[model samples]
Target chain A: MSTAEPPAVAPGATVAELGEEALIALITPMLPHAPGELVGSGDDCAVLALPDGCAALSTDVLVEGRHFRAHWSTGHDVGRRAAAQNLADAAAMGALPTALVVGLVMPPTTTVDWVRDFAAGLAAGCRECGAGVVGGDLSAGESLMVAVTVVGDLQGRAPVLRSGARPGDAVVHVGTLGRSAAGWALLEAGLAPRAETIARAAACLDAFRAPRPPLHAGPALAAAGASSMMDVSDSLLRDAGRIARASSVVLDLGEPEAVLGADVELLEEVAAVLPGTRPRELARWWVLTGGEDHGLLATVPQASLGSLPDGARVIGRVREASAQGPGVLVGGRSAGADLGWDHFG
Target chain B: MSTAEPPAVAPGATVAELGEEALIALITPMLPHAPGELVGSGDDCAVLALPDGCAALSTDVLVEGRHFRAHWSTGHDVGRRAAAQNLADAAAMGALPTALVVGLVMPPTTTVDWVRDFAAGLAAGCRECGAGVVGGDLSAGESLMVAVTVVGDLQGRAPVLRSGARPGDAVVHVGTLGRSAAGWALLEAGLAPRAETIARAAACLDAFRAPRPPLHAGPALAAAGASSMMDVSDSLLRDAGRIARASSVVLDLGEPEAVLGADVELLEEVAAVLPGTRPRELARWWVLTGGEDHGLLATVPQASLGSLPDGARVIGRVREASAQGPGVLVGGRSAGADLGWDHFG
Candidate 1:
């Protein structure tokens, strides 16, 4: 990812030219430092710490066409997205990410610079989140896909599993919702992508590629005594539904306009993409069903709900679980049937 | 994989009918029980205990058309190969197999039964080495590629790193040297199409498709005070070269015949196809440079070598590194360079 591109790489130094050993040499220094990292990028296995009583783990995969468009997201963006998604899952469990292991597959024709940029994206994501890229494998592939597994340190807190949600908790979201979806729509429409802050839009597009999950948010929520939490990879509603179903509780959303923020450039972009359409429809769709944004979602009991830490906002409430569908309710209405992203639909 | 030949699922129902949720439901129960399994297969990550210490982790990718020819290995065989390779790496580290998480990508045209069989292979490999397929991500792809990360418990044993070999250590092999290489030659040569054990030659074909690493060989070496060990996924001469280079030592094979057993059969089959007298040359090539078959190579001090554990045998010994070159020696003569598999070349 050096924008100071001096013809990509030195002449005659192909990705194949580097091979596996040299490739490891090129990528190892980019990783963050971890305590129990007996083995990092080189060799076969990576050894990581567990401390006295805690271990948090999560993994996510991003296929080229299914989760991203190469034309829309740069290689760095793709790496970030891959790392972010996995990191989000670890955060959902109230874990502080310690190390990241990546498995990358790309066509042999792909440039060496692209792989470097991709690794840099993953490194930047981990660096920003305070985690290390511990180990990874690269193979000649037909299409691009990134698989990342994140191992985290809980610092002795009990993992907050999805099934740990209880009734009458406040449903909250950490980080902005619907921005990635809106950015995706803008890019899909061939519109020039811009945000209220050009940097924010770029960051949001970057978030779409490499999400900076509020890993700090999970520990904060746990410290704040939050009950149940999960990363919102799927839409807010769909992910909330997961907590609801797993916890056997009903999740009720307050209102759409109530959750809308003042900074709304992405919504405007979506509107520009579809002329004569209101931003509400696009935002509603993104909030309710779009998957892969990888923000964090949490639910807390009524008493502890007031203790939500920074970067989190109350978006809904949990109700009693019935025999019917379990999910967020809008205006006393359920988010209704599932429309979340499906792997094979 | 039903041994009784269960009905094959149509390609459309691959991941389509079962979906992600159903596929999880189908395989989660098949995983073996483990005390360290804090999390397994259900949630975003599979959690396991670190044995009051650290965990050894390794990942490898087996891509279709690159790692194994799909026509040779059944879908089940591919799955087994994917899981076993990683497990072997962990074992080579003297770590007890604890868990495995896989990221599998394939085209939508794959069959549900094929996936089910693949899962069976993964579960089987896990069972063979005291591990389980704890968690995995399923996605649609352009080709079938299985990426697996295997986690193991050290049980407090010092991890055997590739850099641990010393000048005075004895090199040893814990499994067969060149069966899989010969298997490939047999399949590539259509000479055995009419043999009585044509299916047997096909079994050799199966060997290349899915190498069953001697799972027990690793920990035993660790327990017997082996100094350094690694899995031979590339070739014997090549993988041994890795340990030598990493430890900055020289390896001398002392004239052990490189061919034995069914490897001779492979030469016979090749002779039938090419009709010349080149068994010695052909056998030499397969034993020296074939890839895939994951065998273990270790270096142990000779005093402790007599206490060699089951399945382990001294094949060579370490010598002082020379500035001229550092590599394997055969028959009191320097061996040819470029003796192992290099993916890029």
Candidate 2:
């Protein structure tokens, strides 16, 4: 048999022109090598050494047009967003991220540059949490789609579950709130941020594209005695409600203005530029209902509040479940409505 | 706060009408429960207790029109095939399957019954390999897609890598080969099998729709001292070439006819009914180059040949790499050309 050289990759080659083998060769080196990896790519499966007996697993899927638009997001943005969401799920369970496996389906005409950038972002995102891209599969489809599955090691710690919250716990949040949804609104409204609001607007856009989840805070909170924990992905009220239902308790936001005033204040500058917006009310609504910033939400014993992780603020408190049932309440009253994102609703 | 009952699900409801929450409620119960699971569905992530220190990870993606046409295969068939392929990758690495996480993208119009059946098939496939569906994500898209990632425990055994093969090793294969491709050909040609070939044709079609990979044989071969191994998802020649290149050796098929004659004979009955088909020659070609049956292909020392797992048969021998470099040779001559599947090509 003759050993033939693979065709040189062109600058503007489509995936169909480059073929699967060459495309794989191009992307493989971009993946971060894990220190615990026993076997890497080129095998039927990647063998990884888990740090502990218990492992946490989560998956997330992003579809073109539905989750993103090509014109609005770069390939890097898509990849980073996809990785961030799934990794956040593991962090929500107080686990340290370890590895990720990707499933990508793209139109045959997709450019090689786009895929290369996507791989770079994926590797970068995983590297941030000490994880690596271990294995993946690729296919051709009518539209671009990315599905990522992340694995995490608990490091001998018990997984912090939402069902562990108690009536005397303090409700805490440890990352940005509402910035992503605000950025999306700005994009949809086609409004450019004024000179005074440029930094906040940019931060909003950045959060919308590739969020910096407080992954380190997860394990720290658990170590400090968090009663229950989860990442706020579907809006503060909805996610808190999830913990409430699971724990059979009520999460009561004691003082809306005091608890969320800073987040509301940050959005007022951008809201001022929108023609029909009521700045103060809109900013408050955004803080209460906007989602996708991937903030860590938790409940801790009142005695352990002093030992909570950095960037954490007391947003509310847990109360006994009444005849009204487990739910989220503001100032001892029911929160307005659940405005969380739903794929089909 | 008010405790409200969820709307009752009606017969033949679409995903859009049921919404994300209710749809998930319907599907989660159908997933198999793992014995080692520390946590299951409803949490941000599922926590699993692995049996060993190391785990094997693999992913596979199946696009609607690209991988399977809905008119030819049911949703149950798609789900089963998706789970089976990923699990087979783990088996090929000599790992026992532990858990699976699925990412599904579907159109809003998909029926609840289709999803319920699909979950059943996925659960059944994982159950066969002693695994459970631990977690998954769902989204809406224009076309249906299934992405599955499986985790397997190595049980403290060293993994069998493709780079471990050496000269004088016996090249062996176990399980069916080329049957899925033959079934695909039958579907493409619109040639129904004659009465005499009905049973064989039915087997071919079943293989195409839902491949039954021999899961238990992988660890068996490894325990018996296999040097290298992989599943035959691509054509035999293409996969053999991979092993050769990785191991830096040449796989020499000294007696192709005697090695694969039985598989060739099994295809001839169906071939006889196709117009313009050379039954014997075409069947031989299929046995040589067709793929997607998920059979195990391995190399072992000659002394261990007698200890090989059940259904395994020697098909070739490994030789030191020559100046021509690593490749596959049939009867001491170069195999004509590679015709394995390429996702984008």
Candidate 3:
């Protein structure tokens, strides 16, 4: 953030000193190559082969201060989160991620090393989901913002839409829940400064910084007959409401305590570290209303429940919508409204 | 930019007052539905059919202040420019654009009507290229930033790459040149305030605000056997240099004046309005180094010249790179280093 003499020389220089092209040169080699890319970066467009004849596309934006603080998260962390969120979106559509195009805006004071590390993390995150960074754009701005658009191949299968959940469908979930929110809370409570010294805070902190979404479960759940699916990016309660509204059904989180108890237990230790915090209550709130874990929330037919992918947890059920309208219910009660994060709100 | 009271209540409210979801609800209906889209907005990802089995991808970012001033450009203008640049990149790759995903960040004070207008312009731009606004992400930030990623179908033809320009090929161009730069200069020179009073400034200003790249010519040029092609988003000399370097050949503008005279004449009236400006010299410079025109620059085999698409101008020729290395030569003279805009520089 310093405007002082660039702080380095040559390849180690800041973005302003190195300029856009040179910075791109330093970052491009750090990215893993796409398997069958017809054309890579340094061109008008990157060409990729989509043998399936169909593509699933999603875009996500991460803004500094609003999404993450540079002090709390590294460039690598931002890159991973940016890529993971979009890749998870693709997975939610029952597709295998193939390529991503990034649009990055940063301050001139940003370091080239940070950009390289960001690219490296993007490559790492994409590699996990069988995707590659095909191309990107760069610009100078007051804050660092990463916008990633990921493309995925559907592999000849019909996409599982959010509106396909049936009345008798079983609502299932795969991957961690509420951990990212807990991590965020911990960070907000100054845990970030003491993270290295506190081993108990590591899990939550890591979750908040670079989420490890169960991306593989997306396509697997679809193949296992998932009728409807979405990534839990904006809290379980809110995203469930989205599915409910889209499918014109009620997503009943029957016996919420029993369904979310495991997640609550997972975050108890981390929650306990915060002063005046009720571990169980805090963990439960995080599980229900916390987002950014990128967990898969899906509905599958009751008949196919037995064939669900491993690690899947049947936590709820789809019910017929009443005169009250489509919504999410927890413990046979309304889950309230707007419990998830809203940027402007 | 105002922090005034809620503006005009619900639906006519500011982004902060309406929140993300409601703002999205207002914008979604304005976009045109993409033809053959299996899934559109309101999903984790949009599913699009790519019958050609190949996809051309490109991303471009436009930041407020850096890319445009709110006082000078309307939200619609920004949206059109953002979509145009990415779509042009796809066109440069000899593909037909099908869909786009946008990642938009705006200040909380932004008006809902502005957002709607932006969406309408995005739809308008995409419609021009046979594409649609499929899916996008929105976030809150200090400045308005639009990041668009476009996907295109290659139609079963080999990609025309910048590296395929061979010696003896004729360099061709299709679309306006330097007019965008002239438009930008006009705005920068306080022409925006008096634009309506000066009919001569409208063309340049419009060109700068929303470029109309001849997208249909891309596939046509490819089918006509263009060896290498790229969009001139960054001045003719600079972009030509990119192709030369990529193909390891020199792009020689054998008769610079003859090739660029028409463009200079087109901008003469606009330049004459600006005090202390050398009309012909400024126009010529704009032609040589002004970017954002989104003009197609291509290299075609001499044998295919007669078959080239309408409006295609033969401006230069490809020549073997000597020991001096690959570059662009104007009138048998070397084009100087870095004559185009560099964001960081």
Query: Which candidate leads in lDDT?
Result: 3
* Per-residue lDDT of candidate 2, residues B110-186 (tens digit): 99888888998898888887889988888999999999998888888999888888999999898887778778778
Determine the backbone clash count of candidate 2. 0
lDDT of each: 0.72, 0.84, 0.85
Off by over 4 Å in 3: A1-12, A195-200, B1-12
Chain B TM-score, candidate 1? 0.88
In order of lDDT, best first, we have: 3, 2, 1
What are the per-candidate TM-scores when only chain A is compared? 0.90, 0.94, 0.94
DockQ of 1: 0.61
Which lDDT tens digits does candidate 1 get at residues B214-297? 878788888888888888888877777777777778888754444244545564454344456476666666666766678888
Candidate 3 lDDT (Cα, 0 to 1): 0.85
- Interface RMSD (one decimal) of model 2: 0.9
Give the range of the ten consecutive residues with the poorest summed lDDT in model 3 chain A: A1-10
TM-score of each: 0.92, 0.95, 0.95
Q: Tell how far residue A192 is off in model 1, in angstroms.
A: 3.4
Pairs with backbone N, CA or C atoms under 3 Å apart (clashes), candidate 2? none
Question: Which residue runs of candidate 1 sit more than 4 Å off their true CA positions?
Answer: A1-13, A193-204, A263-270, A323-325, B1-12, B33-35, B190-203, B256-277
Candidate 2 vs candidate 3: the lDDT winner is 3
